[model samples]
Target: MESEIGAFVAVATVLTITPGLDTTLVLRAAASQGTRNAYATVFGISVGVLCWGLAAAVGASAILAASPTAYTVLCVAGAAYLIWLGIGMLRRARNRGRIAQTSGTARMGSTSAAESALRSWSRGFFSNLLNPRFGLFYMAMLPQFIPDDAPHFLMGLLLALIHNAIDVIWFSLLILGVRLMGHWLNKPVVQRGLDSIAGGVVIIFGVKLIIPVIFS
Candidate 1:
């Protein structure tokens, strides 16, 4: 059991550090919106992760994995959502000047800030939730760590919690790192550049996800 846990931790750590959509979203939020917004995004992602874990524990993820129709539907939906989000970010980068001008208006600025916070949370939540790959990962990989003597659901939840803890710790470091670079990241040009890069990466992943479905 101890050895199993150690292996799981080792693998999870590697996964947590690997650059992916989640990392991009969190870093972009920290750089552009501030730590509070980034943390909100983190919370949303945590919730999504928890949901996936629960689904896997209850064998719901098995159904998803087993059903090609269900899996394809989820994959397509996730891909479309990601592409839309990427395009929106690109559009924002393009209109940064106009947005900056609008921010000077007090009433609109406050409303925009509130909306932005909610948007960040929702974006993080849905981005993680909609990705069928996450469900597949939990379904295919998490069970290997469960000891046969232990209750499957409980063990699964515990493992999920461990994964979430790792995520929070890693993301906290990322947020701090981004905050440290606030001086440079705060510059409009730098912010736009980050947005462009993140948007492009997300769009690429979205396209990659859909290509199999498109051709198959």
Candidate 2:
């Protein structure tokens, strides 16, 4: 069991550090909105992860894996959501750029902290939940770590908690790093650049997700 946990941690750590949608979203939020919003995003993503883990433990994810229709529906929804988010970012960047040119200063539109946090959290949650890959991943990868004698549901939850812990630690460090550079990051030029880059990357991912389904 100890070995199993060690092995799970090793693999989960690699996955946690990998640059992906979650990482991109968190970085963008931290740099643009501040650490509080970023933390909210992380919390939402963690909840999504736990839900997937629970689903996988109870064999619900297998249904997603097994049914083409179900998978395709989720794939489409997730892709659309990502694309919408990316386009929104791109629009904001354009607006900011225009404002900067006209007034010699750029400001990304601001929202109430509560509003921003809620939006960020919802985006994070739905983005994670609607991602079929998460379901597939938990279904496929988690069982490998379960001991023969262990309760599958409990073990899965445990593994999920471990994964979440790793994610929190890594993202906290990332948020801190971003905070340290807040001065420069808050600059209009830098903010616009990051928005454009993050938006483009997210759209690319969304397109990638949809293309496979469309062609298949």
Candidate 3:
């Protein structure tokens, strides 16, 4: 059991470190929004993982894996959301000059603290929640780690916790790395560049998710 748990953690850590939607979101936040918002995004993503973990542990996420209709619906919805989000970022990049001029005063005044946090948090949360992959991944992966002799529910939850822990740590490090390069990363030009890259990547992910459904 101990060895299996260790193996699970090792695998989870590798997956957590791999670049994905979560990484792109956090990178954009850290580069453009500031430290507070970046951390908020990380927290939201962690919460999202926890929700999926719980669902998987209890076998609720089987709906996503077992039902093609449900999976298709979620895939389309998630793809739409990602494309929308990416478009917004690309627009910001396009309007970077005007945005830089008004960003300090107008931007802060237009968006309240609470609204900013909520937006950032939701970006992270929904980015994971809507994408049914998390549920499917958890469903397929957790069972493999749990011992037949152990309680399935308890073991699954434990593995999920380990996965989430790795996520928090890995994302925090990413945020900190961005901060360490803040001087250059915070520049309007640099921010726009990051936004463009992140936005394109996000859109590609969205397109990839929906392409199979379209062809099928």
> What Cα-based lDDT does every candidate model obtain?
0.84, 0.88, 0.84
Best by TM-score: 2
Candidate 2: tens digits of C-alpha lDDT, residues 17-48? 99999999999989887887899999999999
| Per-model TM against the reference | 0.92, 0.93, 0.91
Per-residue lDDT of 132-172 in model 3, one digit per residue for the tens? 98789888888788888888778877887788889888988
Model 1 global lDDT (CA atoms, 0 to 1): 0.84
Q: Give stretches of model 3 more than 4 Å off.
A: 101-111
Which candidate ranks first by lDDT, i.e. highest?
A: 2
lDDT for 93 in candidate 2 is: 85
The runs of at least 3 residues in candidate 2 whose Cα sits more than 4 Å from the true structure, single-residue gaps closed, are 98-111
Tens-digit per-residue lDDT, 1-216, candidate 1: 887778888888998899999999999889878877798888888888888988887789987768999989998999999999999889877877566632222122454777777888888899889988889998888888888898888887888888889999999999999878777787778778888988998898899888988998
Ranking by lDDT: 2, 3, 1
Cα misplacement distance, residue 80 of candidate 1 (Å)? 0.8
Candidate 3 RMSD to the real structure? 2.3
